[model samples]
Target: MRTVDFSPLFRSAIGFDRIFDLAEAAQRVGEESYPPYNIERLDENRFQISVALAGFRPDEVDLTVEQNVLTLEGRKGDKEGRTFLHHGISTRSFKRQFTLADHVEVRGARSEDGLLVIDLQREIPEAKKPRRITIGGSSQGNLTQIESEAA
Candidate 1:
C-alpha cells in the first residue's frame, strides 16, 4: 500500500484556517477502527451519517455542534444488577467528531435498530450566495461616458 500526502490539498487558498484543522483531525481519525460508520449523500444538499451502536441506548448518545465541529459520543452504563457468564460483547465508550463546512448545520439525530443516524443540511445565506452581474459595455467606454456625463 502507498501512503498519500494530503497537505497540498489543504493549502489555505480559500482564506479559511479551519480547513487545515479539519485535515489534521482527518489524519487522526484513520488510527481508530472501533465502531464502524457510513456516510451517504441523500440529495444535492442533504447528507446522513450512520454509526453502528449495538448496545447503546438513545439516551446514552450525545450529539453537539461547536466551532464547526460535530461531535457524537456514546456511553454505556454499568450493569451492576446481573452478572454475565460470558462477557463477549464490548460496551466501551466512544467519541467521534466530524468537521463541518461553514454553512452546514445538523438537522437532527435518531436511533433505529442499533443504528444511530445523524442528519445534516447546508444552508447558504442569501447574502453569502453568489449573484450574477450584468455588463452592458466595455470598461473604457463606460468610464468615458460617465466622465462626459459628469462634465
Candidate 2:
C-alpha cells in the first residue's frame, strides 16, 4: 500500500488541525463505494444529503448524530429461500459518515422513493452570531482630533 503525504497541506493551513485528523480517519476506513450519495445546499442555512438506497427499508437503516459527526448505517437481513440467477442488485451493508460544522444540526431524516434524505440546518445562537456595533460619530471625531494634534 502506498502512503499519502498530507503534511504539506496541513502545514499550509492556519487552523485546521481537526480536518487533518478526520482525513486520516477516512483514509483508514477505506471506501464504501456501494450506495452513492449527494449533498445539496437547500438554502442559506439549510442543507440536505440524499443517499441512493434502493433495497433498504426505513427501519433497516440507522441514522445517528454524535458530537459533530453524522453517521448513516444500512444493514439488510438474510435473504434465504429465494434464488436468483443473476444478482445485479446489491443489498450489502454500508456505513457512511459526514462531519458537520459546529453549529449545524440534523433536523430530520426520511426514506422515500428508494432515497434517504437527511435534512440539516445551522442554528447559530444569538450570542454566537456576528453582531455589528454602531460606530459613534463623536468617538471618531475625538480620535481624529487626537491623532491630528499628535501628528
Candidate 3:
C-alpha cells in the first residue's frame, strides 16, 4: 500500500485539514465493496446517494451524520432455523461512510423498492456568499480606526 506525506503542506495551508483527512480516508477505504451504492448530482448544489439494501427493512437500517461524515448501517437477523437451497441475495450487515463538503446538508432520506436514497443540498449562508466590493466606495469615512495607548 502506498501512503502520502502531507506534513509539508500543513505548514502553508489553513482550513484545509478536512481535505487532507478526506484524502487519507479515501486511501484507507479502498478495499471493501459490499452492499453497493451510487452517488448522483441532481443539480448545481443538489446531490443524492442510493444504497442497494435488498431484503432489509427500514427498521433494520440506520443513517446518521456527524462532523461532516454520513454513516449508513444495516443489521440483519440471523438465519438460524431457516434453510435455503440457493442463497443469492445478500441479507448480511453492512456499514458505509461518506464525507460531506462544507455547507452541504442532508435534506432527507427514504427507503423505497429496496433502495435507500439520501438527498443533499449545498446551501451557502448569506454572509458567506461572495459580493462585489466597489473599488472606491463612498462609505470610506464610516470605518472606525483603532486607538493605541503609548506605554
Candidate 4:
C-alpha cells in the first residue's frame, strides 16, 4: 500500500489537525470492526447513530461527549464457568470514537430492541448564522440633484 505524507498539509493549514488524524487512521489496516454501527441524517441538522449491541445491557454501555469527541464503550460481563456448544452472540468489550463537527451536541441515547440509538443535533448560535445585510441608500459625498427637463 502507498503511504501519504501529511507534513505539507500542516505547514499551511491551521486547526485542521483532527481532519488529518482521521485520514491517517483510515489509511491504517487491520483495525477493529466489531460492534457494527450506522450513522443516519434525520434532517438538515439532526443525526442518529444506531449500534447493534444484542447481548449487552444498557448499563454496560457508556456514552460521553468531550471536546467534540463522542465516545462509546461497552464492557461485557464475564460468563462464569459456562461452556456453549454453539455460541453465536458476541459480548466482547469495545470502544468507539466519533468526532463531531462544530456546534453539534449529543441530544440523548437509548437502547431499544437490541439496538443502541444515539441522537445528535447541531445548534448554531444566532450570531454565527448568516443574515442579510440591508443596503440602504447612502451617498459617498455631497451629491447635487440635477433638475430633469420636462418632456
Candidate 5:
C-alpha cells in the first residue's frame, strides 16, 4: 500500500471534492505496476510525462484527455510462431490515468527511444487570472452636468 500525503492540499484548498474522487480512483487501480513511467515538471506551467515502453511501438499506444483526466493505454501486438529461450521483456497492455489540475491541457505526444513522452501545460484564461483594479479618485466631484442651450 502506498501512502499519499494530502496535507498540502488540505491546507490551502477549499471546496475541492474532485481531488478526493481522483484519489479513490487511484486506489482502485493499484498494484498493476508495469511499463514504468515518470512525471516531470519543466516549469511552473509546463510538465512532461514519460512512460517506458521497451517493446511497444509508437502506433500501438493511445492517449486521450477528457474532463481533466489524462489516460494512456498501450496495446501490444500478438506474438506469433516465435519461441523464446528466456522470456524477459514484457509487452503487456496497460491503462494508466492521471488527474490534471484546473486549466491543465495536453500539449502533444511523441515516442522516442522506447519511451512515450507526453507534454502538458496549464493555461489560465484571461478572465480567470487575477487582475489589479485601479482605485480612482472620488467619483462624486467628477460628475459634471451638461449645460443645455435654449430651445
Candidate 6:
C-alpha cells in the first residue's frame, strides 16, 4: 500500500479539508466489496443507490444522513438453531458511508426484491441559485451636474 502526502494540498487549499480526508479514507478502504451496490444518476440533480442485501429485511437495515454524510447500516440476527449444509447467501452486518455534496439530500429509501434503494436529489436554495444581475444604468445622483460653473 502506498501512502500519499497531502501536506502541500492542506497548505494551499481552504475549506477543502473534508474532501481531502475523504480521499485518504477511500484509499484505506480498498477492495471492500461486500453487499455490492450501484450508484446511478437518475437525472441531472437526482441519483439512486441500489445495494444488494439478500436475506436481510428492511427492518434490519438503517439509513441516516448527517453533515453531508449518508450512512447505511445492516444488522442481522444470528442463526443459532438453524444448520445449513451449504450456505450461499450472506447475512452479515455491514456499514456503508457515502459523502454527499452540498445541497444534496436523501429523498427516500425502500427495499424490494432483496435490493435496498436510496434516492437522493440536489436542491439548491433560491438564494444560492445563480441569477442574472441586470446591470442597470448609473444612478441618478448627478442630476444637478455640479453647478460650479454657474456660480
Indicate which candidate wins on lDDT. 4
TM-score of 4: 0.79
Per-candidate TM-score against the hidden true structure: 0.73, 0.75, 0.79, 0.79, 0.74, 0.81
Instruction: Pick out the ten consecutive residues of candidate 3 with the lowest summed lDDT.
Output: 142-151
Which candidate, 2 or 5, would have the higher TM-score against the true structure? 2
- Which of the numbered candidates is closest to the native, going by highest TM-score? 6
TM-score of model number 6? 0.81
Query: Candidate 6, residue 124: CA error in Å?
Result: 0.5
| Candidate 5: 10-residue stretch with minimal lDDT | 142-151
Q: State the lDDT of candidate 5 residue by residue for 14-119, as single tens digits.
A: 8775676668667767477777899999988899999999998878988999898898898988889889999799888998888898898999998889889999
Q: State the lDDT of candidate 1 residue by residue for 1-151, as single tens digits.
A: 3445556765645666566665666666668756789999998678899999998888888889999889888899989897899987777899888878778889998888889989989887665655545566766422112212111
Candidate 6 wrong stretches, greater than 4 Å? 15-22, 137-151
- Give the lDDT of residue 16 in candidate 2: 89
- Candidate 1 least-lDDT 10 residues: 142-151
Residue 31's lDDT within candidate 1 is 82
lDDT of 2: 0.82
Segments of candidate 4 deviating more than 4 angstroms: 1-5, 15-19, 134-151
How much lDDT does candidate 1 score? 0.77
Q: In candidate 4, what are the lDDT values of residues 58-81, reduced to their tens digit?
A: 989999999999999999988999
Indicate the residue-level lDDT of 73 in model 6.
92
lDDT of 3 by residue, 12-78 (tens): 8788977887787788875777789999998788999999999998999999999988999999988
